[model samples]
Target: MRRNRLLSAVVAVCATSALGFTVPQTAAADPGSTACSQMPSDLRPTLILGDTGPAVRQAQCLSNMWGGEPPKLVLDGIYGTVMLKKIEWIQVCHGIPQSGVIEDHTWEVLYHPALDCYLPYPD
Candidate 1:
């Protein structure tokens, strides 16, 4: 009887292990799927010709993401002609449209900063 009980207990343990339970799936599996919806729909560009505040911050962020050599400009939030020129240079280097405006596409590059290849548009 003792040997039979031990064998039965081992069988039960093996059965439970073989039929391992799993937690039910939920919507959290794909976080980015609903990320775009959370953003403001009416968000629009308000680039100032010589205002580099947000633009430069964006550029620096891009620079850091790309692991590229640091840009020669200060991180002041004034988008002056120098910052605009730097933006154009970076865009040209990456073969992006030379809009000289930190638009969505530009912002994508700044945010993602692909290491392998230049991304004209944000993924």
Candidate 2:
């Protein structure tokens, strides 16, 4: 009877331990995992180096969403050398031409960024 009681206690402890433990789940650490809707501009213009205004700010904000971290481009509504390089890297991530220009395809990427990029951020 004592052996049966000990076995029952052991089984109860095991079950309780199992119930207490929680399995770790895969984390969605990428910033672009969320939808891009709060943009400065709804106009999808063809932005290039030396561009400025609301559309440029929108592009800058969207570009910030890539690379799983803070955007290198300031939301100052101006597209300069930094924005150019970042845009090129973004283009590379999407397997597109690194044209440093925000056209239709680039706009698509800016709106819906990848969860992660195979390439590392450029210097």
Candidate 3:
């Protein structure tokens, strides 16, 4: 019984070592971190074409979440066409006008994110 117990312990250790990962000791949200909806206030330069920053990253993250076959944004903070198209899709889904601008309502959708709405727009 002692030999079997030692073998099991060795096997467990070997298996964990083979996995080659360090488990996190603890996890916590940053005290200064803002949620996605609150992300708009962090956006600056109005988040128009060619804009880039933390705010843009925030927008990209939300657009990715808002649901579409929309291309995934890299969160690199650049307001490129991919982000633009995804934002428009989200706006349309939420009944906002399909303007590619990440303005008030668009930002709202990004932050709150659950519009529970989408209309069939003719492509």
Error of 2 at 49 (Å): 0.3
Tens digits of per-residue lDDT for model 3, 99-123? 7888877776665665334544235
| C-alpha RMSD in Å of predicted model 2 compared with the true structure | 12.8
lDDT of 1 by residue, 1-123 (tens): 999998997887788778994322222212233312323323325454565445454454343333344345555656777667656656676678888887766665554444533433221
Expressed as tens digits, the lDDT of each residue in 13-109 for candidate 2 is 7887789953221122123333233343346889899988877877777777665543567678988998898899889989889999999899887
Better of 2 and 3 by lDDT: 2
Lowest summed-lDDT stretch of 10 residues in model 2? 22-31
Cα lDDT computed for each candidate against the true fold: 0.52, 0.73, 0.63
Any runs in candidate 3 off by more than 4 Å, and if so which? 1-45, 115-123
**What is the TM-score (0 to 1) of candidate 3?**
0.57
Task: Report the poorest 10 consecutive residues by lDDT, candidate 1.
Answer: 22-31
Judging by TM-score against the true structure, name the best candidate: 2
Candidate 2's displacement at residue 7, Å, is: 46
lDDT (0-100) at residue 30 of candidate 3?
21
Could you give the candidate ranking by TM-score, starting with the highest?
Answer: 2, 3, 1
Clashes of each: 6, 1, 1
Off-target runs (Cα >4 Å) in candidate 1 are 1-48, 52-56, 68-70, 116-123
